[model samples]
Target: MVTDKQNISVNVVDYPYDTSVPLLDNEQFFYIRDEKRHKGRGLAAILTQPPSVQYRTLAERVKNQSKYGFPSHKLVLLIHGHQSFKNALYQPLLADKLSQEGYYVLRIDFRGLGDSEDCWDPKLGRTIKQDVEDLTTIYEFVSSEACKLLLGRTLTLDTIVAHSRGVISMFEFAREVYVPNLINCCGRFDSHGLLLKAARRSPTWEADGGFYCHTLRFGEWQDVWIPKAETLSAGTLDSSKFKEIDSGTWVLSVYTATDPIIPITAAAGYSNLFAGRHTLNIVPNCDHNFYGLPDDPNKLNLSLRKGKVNYGVYLVKELVEYLKEENQLERFYKTHQLIKSAKNEGDVRNRWCLPYEFSQISNFRDVGGYTTGSGTQVRPGIMYRCANPNEATAGALDYMKSDLSVNKIFDLRATNEAIEGGIIPEFDVENLSFNNNMTLSPEEMAKHYQGMFLSSYNFPQAYEIVLENSLPTIRHIFEYVLDGNVDEKHAIVFHCTAGKDRTGILGMLILGIAGVDVDTISHDYELTTLGLCTEKRLIAKINGRGDKFYTILGPKGREIAAAYGVTPTEMAANVLSSKYEAMRLFIDSFLSKFGSFDRFFYEQLKFNKIEVEKIKFHLTI
Candidate 1:
């Protein structure tokens, strides 16, 4: 019995205003656009007074009895994402749901769809950027009217709920504007992956200009062939660019347990990119569109209590609850900021630093939880990386053995460095040396430090040398991980002295191949300074003990060390430090030289295709 007549009502609620004077009493359906597009699209919006409450917003104050409604209040904006999707799909249901809960809501559609007018020319290609532009225009209008309605009182936008592809526009808008809260539902960060799949299915989509995207709509399959140019121009979802986001913008990623266009792992991928800035809320038994499962997939399983479940109501409820609670809202964002600034150190995962009572164990932390573009996350608590575990506390060693379930340790230090540092426990250790004085000698190392005191270029070049030389050793490390006996719960630790240089390069290669972004890799490498500052200082403390350490440094190195009040060894190790740039440059070289991380694994490392899957499956979920 549902018909076009079932379109959501445009009735806007009004109250006692200057009745004689004209006011925006009814929902206004008008045209809005960006600076360029004079031929704009339709925007339907309504602002209403907050629901009368008996208590003050923050509590411990007299409740307002004024008929005009509370001046300072909560407001929400709902937006549909894809140009193909209509606002009527969920706008009315959400608008009413939020309004009943004391929020003034405004929902809108992008141009060229629903009630919204088409962009002047269809040939301009409806890109996500245009949707962003349209959204920006609407927000400006809504905010202005909202401020007036609230009488200049502060309006806390609980969140702007954007669905699917609409999340792309919302994220883009927040990067530039002040978006207080954001909810991204089933958003795909890797647009290329979708296209690649499409190309595989159609075989001629990319070259022929379009592809058939068969999607389920209204319980029926439909051919939704969109142009390749339009999708490509929408831009890829590179969340690394969102690191420096607006201070006020708190992001919450919510997705159904089942997804069609985007993978279930996409949520984890976003959290990986957003790091501490994002939290996840999974809606069980629902698909990408937020529809519930009709028949339980567990109908055959009588051993477990399970049945058909729907996320339709549960999804919206979680969102509303997140907005209401400050703890849930600010959790991930605060955590992310703390880690990014290196303000936290209780756990290595908190800031990716290895805590130790002694100087040997540095940069020790799990390397899993990084995600590939396909939404697969490197399983957490599995792969750990660090500096030498030589002379590690028994308790610390026990924690790694038991908690991390680490059975293997790949030691990347040269035989000499191992002998000098003292060998780690003989059991569970593999010496995979990269710098064996093969190309760079101890004198050359001293010279490199001396030259480095003059310029900063040698730091990343040192990383390049590790990447260039440690081919077989790196292959074996992955092989250990890919071994059939290993599972997601099992972990292995890789280390070298200082863990910031050789350890960092190896860490970067592993994480990079695992699909971690450059920013995260840099962040992980930079965590070494927080964990090893004392270790670096220990070098300076050995002032008179190691005279040979200074003698190896000739003159220039000695001058740099003395100026810094440390030995030449300290000068070399401490001067390099754990820099974000060092790891970043290393990854850049990896990508440039190898073409792709996976290709480097298969072609350069000579890993079989089956082994590659084993590696990814074991490493990522």
Candidate 2:
């Protein structure tokens, strides 16, 4: 039996997980939180080296919560089948078994199942779509701040294992959310297919995609009419469409030989769809619940062939083996797709963008092979930027507080805006007063403005600010860069809210001064719009109110230019007009004040000269 004897540290934050809050009933679900404890032989540790990955964190909620050396770990969140939550005795037992073999388990009762606050009812006319939403919400909660608090910092979720109906909900969740590992046990196909088969057998089944589907036959309304086998058999599983993820994401499919819900052929078909990316295990003699007993209410007559059954020690061993691939796990899973997106499209989920999570307003990104004058590209993550920290998640705040170890935060927001938003909480909130706010009253400015004045006033004001209020701030930023902190565990993050306008202007100027081309700067600045777009659901809500402003203003170029307080022309010039009048004046004035910009950076900031040069070389080349 495994005995956790080490002085395991617990870091749970006291956060509430309330169930009464009204759910949007639209793509939002809840993940039940359950923890079980028992004894076992120590499971071989996986994901040990990546200092980034939290390992063996034990929570105080488990039975024998105080045991130390056992190396407390997190259980995968498992969702049970329809009516399955009503009976989760098997889940805890499974968790116990896995724990004996070293698996911390968290079996959740789906929102509508078991002791969960919500319940699904055909008479109430609840749609499966609602269930899907509830599942997603629950999934997020499981991995969110409130869930993390429950587990504490010492133990965190290492994987998510979903069963049957839970797998369907999780499949939806995986498409939208990012989880490292997923284990599918006795998973079935989609709801339409599952319901269709039931409908054929019991005429009461009716198609329900939620609110959109309802049918009346003669004088009565039939519950469901959709056929499952016909719909799915017509088209194979579309695994190719899944978001391109890194190889580090591992998938394991576990099926029982006698499971009626998921026959061996069907399981094999699903496994084949994932092919190289997935592994399949079939348990022998066991029923769907994996317990033996012919007359058990929970048992199913799922026929098992000797060839298909590969249960017991072998399945557990394979799971342990696949999870231990050191090389893949060591470097954080940066999928080729993720790397590409971050470099080309500015996807926040990209590996390079991970740094942004730490800074409240950092326009954090990877500076991949962006060509310099010398035909080289800056290394990703060596530099980052963002809007002011008016809003930051607790996880983000902590990253800034410690891991970032940043030396400075160049605030570009007018002092008024900063105060209005409340003082940003940071170790060092440097006030580089780029006090570029317009001095003229709205009336006076309106009278004098012409051309893009009313339309482009914000852009010119951005320029004016850089020329007037931002020079010193730029000098300060340069000094910070030259301080040689770039190579250390710390760097710098600076921003103005709407990180686009002032922040973009400042970033462009800084990169230009450092010899990064204007085109590249414009490209980087424009990418902000991608992240700031309101989610589709919010937009739909607005549309319902006859709102078209977002739809109209969402033109790619317009959005990009708007972020930086300039037109696309200004952006092109910022790059193409490197020697243009505005740029020349800004660069010349800054240099005059501190010799060359590089000199100010090197002499003023304590940065290592070589590292500064290296940074410059990457950007300029």
Best by TM-score: 1
lDDT tens digits, residues 1-621, model 1? 111121211222332122221323323333333335435324434444344433443211112212223222446777775544333344555555555555666665566554455644555555767777776665554434334333333234446888877777788877876555788988777766656656666788768787656543322346645676666755455656666665435688987776767787778787887764677988666666665456646332322212334344566667767755234323422443222211223533532434666324655666665445565655666677776677777767777666657777778888777888766673477788985437676765665554333222236555666666778888877877777545535667777776667777777777776776555566566666655655644445444345555555565545655543454445455354664444554565676688778888888899988888777776666
Q: Where is the poorest 10-residue window by lDDT in model 2?
A: 37-46
Candidate 2 RMSD to the real structure: 24.1
How well is each residue in 1-621 modelled by candidate 2, as lDDT tens digits? 111222111222221233322222111222233222101110111111111122232112112222211222333555566445422324433443445433344554443334343333434422344445554544444334444344332233456666765666566556655455777777774344564545555564334322222332212334432333222322233444443433435567888887765667657666666655676777666556554445433234333333333233334455555444232232123322143322545533343343444534444544333434443434444455665555666777676547545555667777787787555675567666564454645443332221112132123433543455445566566555555556325556666654555665566655654665443344454455442332233234433532232233233434433443443333332321111122333333455565654565566443566857755753442
Among all candidates shown, the one with the greatest lDDT: 1
Q: Each model's TM-score, in the order given?
A: 0.45, 0.39
Q: Distance from true position, residue 78, model 2, in Å?
A: 1.6
Residue 266 shift from truth in candidate 1, angstroms = 30
